[model samples]
Target chain A: MPLSSRPVSRRTTLAAAPLLALAGCRWGPAEDGDEPAAEPSNAVPDEQQVKAALQAIADADAFVKDVSADHVGLAEPLAALTALHTAHQALIAKEGDTGTTVRMGTPTRATAALKAVRRRELGLQRTLTKLAGEVSSGELARTLAAMAAGVAQQVALLPETAKDADA
Target chain B: MTGTDALQTTLAAEHAAVWIYGVLGGQTSQSSQPALYDAVTTAYVTHRSRRDQLVRWVRDADEVPVAAEVAYELPNAARTPAELKAIGLQVEQRCAAAYADLVGRTTEDERAWGVNALVESAVRQLDFDGDPTDLPGIDA
Candidate 1:
């Protein structure tokens, strides 16, 4: 689901305000004789990126469910892919939750669904990397990077590659 | 940590991986454990290639790449194929952690390389009989 659809708490918005201020600071000129403001020691995580990650997990769960219902042969690989998504969602949710609202999309055929998930995994990889760049917390940034790597590995294990592996 | 520092850490981890794989392949029985031996051989080549790439990256950035130790203490003697797999798995996990930190520290080309390294480490986790983790490097 989009961030707009999720009900972000008032506290969450307030918590993320410093990052918004940082974004705005990028536009303004420095005042004369004043040193640049020091970075906050405890900066908020990037809200939009967190929301998008949560959405990606929900999408993966729904798609895997759809594809698994129709294709038994694809089940094992899909399960592993789904597990990765689930684990990502759990970590992100624990960090700063804007509640997940499942927005289900139409499922394609087995091959197509695998391709679709691969595309989604690639998207997540990019998003997580961008998010890693934006966040101030070293720990959080490393976690995001690790998750991105997990997605990349999942992308490599798509249906076409699975067939290649068997061959 | 700074990008250079992270890169150095990764270089060290890769060095350790290359060393461990060499010891692992030397000690493990190739005739009795063909598949395990083959996997170790492939892993050794991959780590050697990565170690070389890391050296070039550090050199390109005008930084001194961390040198491999004369020897590393093995977690165990790794007398069996299973023990060798365990050692391989541990080294890959350490590499994943190092590369994950590098991903956060570096940008543009270096960051891209770090991402690929992290991914390769995670995939190698599977080859070593480790499960797919939600977070490869992170404890939580």
Candidate 2:
């Protein structure tokens, strides 16, 4: 699907249009404090949003790791993210899961997945920069506590909008 | 779902679906039932517009879009009025679920569009099924 989602805010829309240019690019947050990343807020979000986002993250991660990755450069991170993606997808759909399926490839799915994961990691590193260090959803301490997930799943590779930061 | 192939396939499905809904919704000339009929018509147009938008996007990206099938395998043989609505509702549900599945596979930006489209389909399905809240499960 062209995914014709409704257009987002002007700020984010301006930032998102040039993503392909940054596909191979890298950036680091400001030193003393990650200025680009938000100072984590202490406010809580709707439980439903958290649950939905968690589930959505699962599926998104799968896309990164599932396909033939023989041509990719990193295997371990890819495999790990693939595992995490599947787990998140299952959780979003509200289903229990088994272990991740390992897809064999020429270059090894691991390398590409790792690079993808690193990109996501860097993205999040800058993103969480804005958030206050300590926060939580509902009565929990943080997203992890709110999620209370057992599976070690990697988060999403791309932000919904470059404007969303970590999400 | 985030794969180039998967996204292209989904875009193709939506293209055909929008066209089919257009013809199916339009063939019925129940103007007397204005509210109901108009709803169907609007859904068809909305989907069709979305289809065109998607096709253009695919072309712009130098991607091959899915071709329309000679004929769709309707969820079932919808003969009577009730059957037509049933089939229509089923198609919408499947479409909704398909998008929901994509919500997981693609980037955040991609998922936002999916969420909107899914909601639009779900609303139409609810109208057809008489229960706007009910939706099919994801194929995970």
Candidate 3:
């Protein structure tokens, strides 16, 4: 027999299987007719994602925490909004940009919606910041809720954000 | 939104914080009440540092984060240290929760920052509220 026609080696076959496994991930059960399993829907949005957004917002809050008493001032909500637009843009894009995968699939539309919400949040952040500066009567308290709510509402729309993000 | 989505939420929170501190500081500065001025100024410095870090964070992410304006107005007359501190505490609590909200919602790689943020805000609130036990990293 020609050298080219050598018999199959056990070591080569064993090596091949592991390499194949390494190259691709398998979803679902092996017995399910060889196709990967389908992913479940609506796992609650990750808390970490929410936490990060809040943390970023907190950093913004930290700035204004004492502004009211400082006798200093600014009107930069619009600027804040613009910066937010620039800052998180990648995460906003990445959460949805990748093709479907296990964890990566989670953010889906929620990411985009948050992108919108975050943009709004920036506006609100500034609006509220300015309001905080101008805070005199209890009127600020009254108006603050609406602005905060607007941001929260957008955050509240995370489910929607996630949907489009996943879709 | 993903971890970054939650991160985005923090942007507004930090904005709120910056506003609160700025308001309190300016009001106190105008009054020039010694004790109140010191406290409010301290608070403002804290907030300003926090704000700058946030801005840097946003920038590090390669996003177009906003810049603080030349000035903001004071809503009411913040004439006392107590009043300014109250404002700080209130806003800090809110910011803490905001970060906490994220901690509860996200997972994996994003959780670390969220938790760190929660700790930061909670500790800050503790300082403002004068209850060390209210959060971690404070002694009895």
Candidate 4:
């Protein structure tokens, strides 16, 4: 088992069981010898939404890495933010998402880059919050909501200039 | 769990949080540790308001709200400001988890309320020197 495949395998096993359990009222027990019911209509859409959300995270991670690399002074301050994106990717990324690559545009000066990152972080928080409510699975919704809250915490601690940027 | 059950569980956590914050606020000094004092006081007031809101929500659903325990056992003696901050962090972490669970088990207005509470608790954790994480309530 390759290291990269670990999260995909975990998600594959964990996803179906919880949806069935949570939607128990809508899905009755299968009769003896009966074929498994058709896949839930919402499952594909939910996966697509999750993929898009994961892509957004990847983009942010790449941007942060680029900025940190260019501005050595920022490496320490942005370390937690990078770790946050990694943790989120682990939880939300699905099969095929591991190899996904996103193009992060050219970086600006350190101060400008930090402000831009802060804006993007806030934008990502909003995206996660909206997706949380839109998802069909309650469990996934909770995870996304928590992710948004996590972003909120980091956003709150950004440099004082970043705060001014928002205003 | 049912939505009602999630609400009751969160109500119970809020009860404990309110009591614990009260104790933490009392232990923190106003003059020497003004910053810690303000954090504890703010948390105390926020938890109290959240507890009251939970009670109203439970009653609105026609379910009996769970009552707070007469006292909650402190995790530590909390004799110093650092210890008090630790307790404050723990309380916010626990409440964040409860709010996350509530978000899953609810919808519409209740779910919105749960999301707001989870966000507030996550930010509050930083005041107590908590490390920011990828998932606030879930990881906590």
TM-score each candidate. Answer: 0.69, 0.44, 0.35, 0.79
Clash pairs of candidate 4?
none
Q: How much is B71 displaced in model 3, in angstroms? A: 7.9
Using lDDT, rank the candidates from best to worst.
4, 1, 2, 3
User: lDDT by residue for model 3 over B19-45, one digit each (tens)?
Assistant: 767677666654456755665566567
Candidate 1's iRMSD: 11.6
Give the TM-score between model 3's chain B and the true chain B.
Answer: 0.61
TM-score of 1: 0.69
Predict model 4's lDDT versus the native: 0.74
Ranking by TM-score: 4, 1, 2, 3
Residue A71 deviation, candidate 3, in Å?
48
lDDT of 2 by residue, B1-140 (tens): 23344356456556556655665575455765565567667777776776676677567668777676666556555545566677566656555544544443343344445545554665566556534221221311
Residue pair clashes in candidate 1: none
- Runs of candidate 1 with Cα error greater than 4 angstroms are A1-45, A70-83, A93-140, A152-167, B29-31
Best by DockQ: 4
> What is the iRMSD of the candidate numbered 4?
8.6
User: Cα deviation of A141 in candidate 2 (Å)?
Assistant: 22
lDDT at residue B87 of model 4 (Cα atoms)? 88
Taking all chains together, the TM-score of candidate 2 against the true structure is: 0.44
